[model samples]
Each structure stands twice: as structure tokens, then as C-alpha cells.
Target: MAEYLKLGVKNEPAMSQASLGFVGRSVAVAVVEDISHNLDPNLFTALKDAALSTNPDESKQAVKAALAHGTHPEDIADFYIPALARDMGDLWCADQLSFAGVTIGVSRLQAMLRALGPNWASDNATTNENASILLIVPQDVYHTLGAIVLSSQLRRKGFSVKLFLGGKPEDIANHITRTKTDAVFISSSAGETLEKLRQIIEVIRGSSGATCPIVIGGSILDVQEIHDVTALTGADYATKLPDEALKLCGLQETEKKKISARNGT
Candidate 1:
């Protein structure tokens, strides 16, 4: 967690050695696969060794250095999710697993902002006041890291956002009905469970009676074919992340202004 914070603040050199030890080999591999071009090999080697080390302090320092090297938020997110999920089963209270997932997801998002720099949000803000949004993920889409990261980005950009995850279709409909949401974001990482996402979208759209925007995302929709699937199922917006989806929905500027004002900038 300290590594996550250090990366977010761009205080790369300040990360404690112990924090790096928590990052695992899979995380190192993911980081390399995602950002090897931007990072030094020696730093990565140190991270890998730390991940593999039995010594707790050495491992922590190594992970800290790798994080300090910085990588894209999406890649960081991908690296953190599995590691978080594995550790969650033992660390989190049984009833709080979902909350833990949300925390892990948001932390990765902060890491992304750290790696990508804060200027990324500048390109997408809008002045429109009517650009409210709602981000919804299917009840079974337990991998909330992507959605949470996207939500954090959108919130930072000033969009009015209501994040809902892992709920029944009826619950989704009820929220849409009550909020009159301008957009709905859905995430489905499951390969075979896409039908469930479709059904929920259809149900929400049909029940809303208005042509509310629907966005679909996740590993399943990472493919071009899934874009077509999203269209076929009546999703008006589709992207791999919430930031991109908001761009598709024409709310970028409005969100940015809101964020800027909130930050007193």
C-alpha cells in the first residue's frame, strides 16, 4: 500500500524497501509486459529479485523501486488486481471482500495517475452542466479494479458519478429509474457470462423508457468483436475504461471543469 501511495505521489525514491517486497513475480511480469519500454532493465531486475526474495525487507525495497520506475495506470491496475485478490481471501473480512476489492482498484488508479502524470485529465474536461453519469458493473464482475479506477478518474475530472457494482438487474433498474442516469457503465470479465451483461443492459434500457446511454467494458469486451456485441445489445458507449467511456458520452469537458473547480484550481 505504501508503494501504491509513493507511486501516486511521484515520490519514487521515497518508497520504503519493505513496501516493494509485497509485489509478486506475476506483478513484475505484468509490469514488464506493460511498460518495459519506459523502464530500466536493472530496476526491473531488482524488482523481480525482490519479488522472489524470501527476505521481507529486501523484497519490499525491490517492489518500491519498481513502482518508483512507474508504469501506465492500466498496466499497474492489471498487475495489482490478481495480487490483491489472492491476498484478500486471507486479509479481508469475509463480508468485506468486495470493499477490499474496491480499495485495491482505486489504489491502482492512483498509481496510474502517478505514472501517466496529472495532465492526462486536461484533454477531456467539458463545460456542459447536464453531463451526469452512472457507472454500473454486473453483480458477478468481482474484478472491480478496472471500474473503480475508471470511476476515480472520472470523479477527478468533475463528472457527477454514481458507482454501482455486483448487483441484481432489478437493483440496477431501480437505480437507473431513481437517478434518471444519463449513462450506465457495465463491466464483465467473464468469458462465458457475457449473456448476463447483455441481459442487464437490455433490462435497464427497456425499463428506463428513455434512451439512456449504456457502456460496456471488461476483459471480455477488450476485443473488437465485443464492440460489435455491445452495439448489438444496445450499448451506446463502449470502452475499456470509464475515462474513455465518458469521452464517448460527450461529458469530458464538463467533468474536467468540475474537478478543477473542486480542487480550487
Candidate 2:
């Protein structure tokens, strides 16, 4: 990652594995390391520039070049694309990019992910009911790139993911009542109020009969502390890591566990 992209983002101090419980922390660390190791910095720069360029075809050409270099489509969708989105968000925060610039960049990223094919989501779904999830972005929250990327991630993890973007609390609750959602993951932005989250979560709880686990994530988690979200929103858990959220809901098994079970070890 470029140092310039790190502007306005809070950096966490180093801590021992024992100081923080290692299980979830280790998983998050491994995820970061995996993306950093696989992503080509040069290609990332090109992709970022292309996505923000005036011509829409520039982004496609960049993605084509990435694929030609033998880059896995999933890697592009999961790691490269999300990193670009995050950078755009950080740039917007630092006043380096306007809201319009970030919006355009994110739209291009979404199109690029879609061009990667059905395999990015559906091919990996495996149609397991246990993996069914409802991903929500509360009404008035403008930061949707993270939610879109997360939906793709969850789908690629074999979860049947549904996105409810900017829906009213009553409507969101109605959908929850109709769907077989194993968990409800809400993606919120920084400017959104805690009272709004509380109200939405309250409605979702009523609709879900208080059985579904509601996990809040997105840029809100980046700016606000996790403990504060859980405390203020009546959420079951709070984290930006998809794996952690799913594990907390008892929906997703660890990769190690999945591999061991598959290998009969």
C-alpha cells in the first residue's frame, strides 16, 4: 500500500498475541498478509488510475491486463478492488478526492467486479442455507462500495448473500421476515447517528424475533471504536472482518477447520 493512501487513517499500535485474544486477531492478520502478498503494487496503481479516468474503457483494459498477467479473478475482486475502494475513501477524507471523484471510482470498481464473471459470487455460493446472509446499508448512508465488496466476499465464501441498500427500517424488517437470513450484517458510514442504528437494529430485532445476529461494519468501524458500536446500537457484535462476524454468528467455519474436514483429518 502507498503511504499517501494511509492519510487520515488511524494506525493501530503493535500488540502481543497474548494481550489481545489471538484467534480472531490472528485470522484478521492472516487476511491482511494474504492480500498484501498477492497484490501487485504496480498493477494496483494502474487499476486505481484507470478506474478514476474519464473513459470507462480504461478500467476494463486495466482489468484485462491484470487477468492476462494470470491474476486470479477472485483476487482482483476480493483484495485489489477493495483496497482501491478503501484508498478512494481515505483520499476523500483527506480532501484529496471530492465526493464525486470517490463515487465515480467506486462505480467503476463495481463494474469491474461484475465483468469478472458469475464465478465471483454464484460459482462459489454452494447453495448452503446455513450460509444465507442479509447485508444492509442503512438509509442515508452514502458509502456503499464497502457493502458491495463485502457482499461479493460473503458470496465467494459460499454464503447466499442478499443486499438491502438504503432501505427503510420497516422495509428492511419486512424483508428479514420473509428471508431465511442466518445473520444480518449492517454497513454504516461515519456521519450516521447512533440513534439511527439503534432504531434500525430495534426494528430488525423485532422482525427477526430477536433470533438473528446483527453485526455492524464499514467505514463507521474505521472511525468509531467497536465497543462503542455494540454499546450504542444493541448489536450482537461489531467488526469490519467478515470472517469474524460470521464466526460470531456461528455461520462460517474457519478455513483450517473447513480444510481439515474436507481432508478427513
Candidate 3:
């Protein structure tokens, strides 16, 4: 893969594994490994460029070319596309791209995933029908690429996910109540910030009481921040990765057990 890409680089094993979920002996874990190990660096570059392209057709061609080698669509959606989004974030932080450009890049990634057809999410979903999840993308925040990607991941894992965005606290709470969702998710960057997220949690809890689980995730959710989020906001689980958030909510099962999940306490 690197030979075609001409980039003598590989993400560390730990970093690669974290993007999917904690690697395990499961078939799902193995599939993630297959895609992670197979990404061509050149393909990755082209994807990044495509995502940031101003012309939608140009972006399509870039994604089309990457898959020309018979690359799995899931590999692009689940692996490379996400990596490109993060790369766009990195470039934004370095002043290489503006916020608008980054947003467009993420939109492009979503467009590519949407183009892959209906089978992609179902192919990845577990048959268990484990949990009903409310994936919230709060108002006043623009970047939803991670949430978009995470929604697909959760759907793939058998959660009936409803994505919420730009709604009032009452509306959000009402939707959760109306749908009887089992889990509520809030990313740090989803709304104004973590502090605002704390308020969202408070409002949801106030409206719903203690029945539904509130889970928090995002790039900002390191171990300490996770503890802080739960402590400060009355949230039940916090994770740095979207898939790990599922584990924290105890929505999926595997051969080994993790101790951190509170399962909505």
C-alpha cells in the first residue's frame, strides 16, 4: 500500500486501533485491522485534497479514483475518510485551512459515505438490535463530521440511532422522551463547548429524570476530562472514541469484559 502511495509512513498500531474501537479477537476487530493496515498513503492524500476541494465533482472524482483499485467502500467511510477529517482539523489548527474549508471537507466526506448506498450501514450493524441511541449534534457548533461518521458506526453496530441537531433543550428532551431512546450522546465540539454541554445534560436530566443514559464523547475526552464531564454534568459515561462510548454504555458485548462501563448507572 505504501509503495503505491510513495509515503514511507504508517500510523502506530495503538493509534490505528483506537480509531475503530479497542482491538479484540472478534471478527469485527479483525475487519477493522484489515482496513487499517491496507490504507495507501497516496490514497489518503488524494482523499484529503478531495475533501477540501471547492468543486463537488472534483471531490467525487478524487474519491472515485481512490476506490478505482477495488478498495472497499467501508475502508473509505470508516477509516480513510475519518482520518482525512482529522487531518483537516489538524490543518485548521496549523492555519493551513480555514474553518469554512474544514467544514466543506467534512461535508465532502459525508457526501462520499452517502454515495456508498444503503447497504454500508446495514453490513456493519449487529443483528442484536441492542439499544436505541440519540446521537445529538447540538446547536451553535458547525463541525459534525465526527458525529456523522459516528452515527454510521453506531448504526452499523445495531443501535437504532436518531441524530438530533439545532433543537431547543425542550425539543431535544421531548424527542428523547417521545422516542424512548436508551442513550443520549453529546460531543464536546457539538455545541458551544463542554460547559454548555453540561447545561444540555442538566436540561435533559431535568426533563427525563434518571432513566436514560447520557454519554459524552469527542477529541477533548481524555481520561481526566471524561471524569470531569461525568462529575460536572451528571453524565453516566464519557469516552474519547465514539465506539468506546458504546462499550461505556454497555450496548455491545464481546468475549472480554471492560470494567469502566456504568450502563447508565
Candidate 4:
């Protein structure tokens, strides 16, 4: 985990860019395939197009069809949904699409997620027994889809996560202590200026939960910004993506111990 922070946020690899044709392997394929074997081409394209569509009803039909055909909710959430976002980001940068379009796209995707609500929770018995993790959406921030995605991934990996969508620092601290949270995660946003990061960090530091490690990230933080934030704040670790956040917080690996114990290895 320390190694990842040291290396910092990576540009989407050269290989990933070349494989946009859906002809090869990448983190998306590897991660999504592990959860579901039914990677239907139609399902994949349906999700992609639905996220970019302007019409809510049409997008709903595509997302619903994918779910009805046995594409797992977790798969859609973690896999195809983020891909659409990235694609939108690229288009926006190139001025081919408006930011408003991207926002609408995500709203449509969220509709699919809301529709798939309960199935998103993990059924793993070990997860229910795991230590608590608090995912806080810090003050004044609205979108927390990144944190939500990490929470789902963590739960699937057998960690108990409590996502605090919005709250005061003292209240957040009280909840963390009452739950005996093992760690906490928070995110700014894609365009965060970090003008208030220091204040936000201080609030977390003053809390009873301050002793637990805090991992922070936002889309705006490039490799240099990540290092800068780490240097300027009480953050123990940083990453541009939530998967790395889980690794740095050391939650993603805990499930391995359960498997080893069951095998008596």
C-alpha cells in the first residue's frame, strides 16, 4: 500500500488505450470477470450506450435488460458504469460532449443502481463479522459515487462498511468511535480545488477517530497533487482510485486470511 502511494496515480496504461475496441484484457475485464462469467457483448454495449443516452426511459430499458439477462448488479456498478464515466471525461476534454451530458448520463446510471439496490449488498457470512469501516462524504460535497463504489467492493471482499453520506465532524467521530471503526475513507470530488482540504483534514484529525488512518483522494489530484496533499495534511495515504484506497487502508486483503484458515494452511 505504501508502495502504491509512493508511485502515485497512473495514467491509463498504454495497453488500456489500445484495447478500447473491447478486444483485449484490462483491470475492468479481470475484476468484472471474477464476479460474473456472463460478459455478454450486448450487455456491455447496452450499459455503455445507456449511460451516455439523453433519454431516461431508453437508458432504463437498456440497463434493465442487462440486469434481467443475469448481469450482476455488482458487475454493472463496478465495471461498466465507471467506464462510461471515463469515456465521458475523455469526450468532454476533447469538447465533443458537454459536461451536462455527462451529468445526465450518471443520473441515468444511478437509476439502474437504485433499481438494483438490495442485490448490491454482500451475502458473505465473513463480511458480516468483519471490522467496521466508515466512509465519509465530507462537508459540502454532493457526489459520492466513488466512495459508494469502494464501499460495495469492500463489502464484497468481506468488510463491514458504514458510509456516512453527510455529517458534522463531531458526529462523524462519535459514530466512528461507537462502532469501533478500523479505518475511515473520504473523497473530495473531480474538480475539487483543495482550498478546503486542510480544514477538512483538521476536522478529521480532531475527532476521536483521528488515530485511525485516513486515506483521501479526489479526481483533481494528479500524482503531484496527491503527494502535495499527503505532505500538507494528516492523511496517512492517498490514491486517485478507491481500489488503491482499500489496499492502503489494508481492508481488501483481510479476506485472504479467512480462506487460509478454512484450508488450514
Off by over 4 Å in 1: 1-129, 190-192, 241-243, 253-265
Model 4: which residue pairs collide? none
| Stretches > 4 Å off in candidate 4 | 1-45, 52-55, 68-72, 90-100, 117-128, 166-170, 193-195, 241-243, 259-265
Give the best candidate by lDDT: 2
* lDDT (0 to 1) per candidate: 0.51, 0.71, 0.61, 0.58
The sequence of per-residue lDDT tens digits that candidate 4 reaches over residues 1-265 is 2211221224433434332322111111112123334445667666766666545676778767877777777777777665555555565445454445545655665666656655444323233465567777766455555555666666766677777765567777577656666677766554344546666667766765467778776553543477777777667887766667777777657656666776899
How much lDDT does candidate 4 score? Answer: 0.58
Lowest-sum lDDT 10-residue window in model 2 = 22-31
lDDT per residue as tens, model 2, 145-246: 667677777776667788776778888888888877778888876556788999999999889899888998765676689999999999999887788888
Q: Tell me how many residue pairs clash in candidate 2.
A: 0
TM-score of each: 0.53, 0.77, 0.71, 0.68
Give per-residue CA lDDT, model 1, range 37-93, as digits (tens). Answer: 454456444543333333435544544555666644444334443343334333323
RMSD of each: 11.8, 9.4, 10.6, 11.0
Candidate number that wins on TM-score, 1 or 3: 3
Off by over 4 Å in 3: 1-38, 93-95, 117-130, 190-194, 222-224, 254-265
Q: What ranking of all candidate models by lDDT puts the best one first?
A: 2, 3, 4, 1
Error of 3 at 263 (Å): 25
Candidate 3 total steric clashes:
2
Error in Å for residue 227 of model 3: 2.1
- Tally clashes: model 1: 17
- Residue pairs clashing in model 2 are none
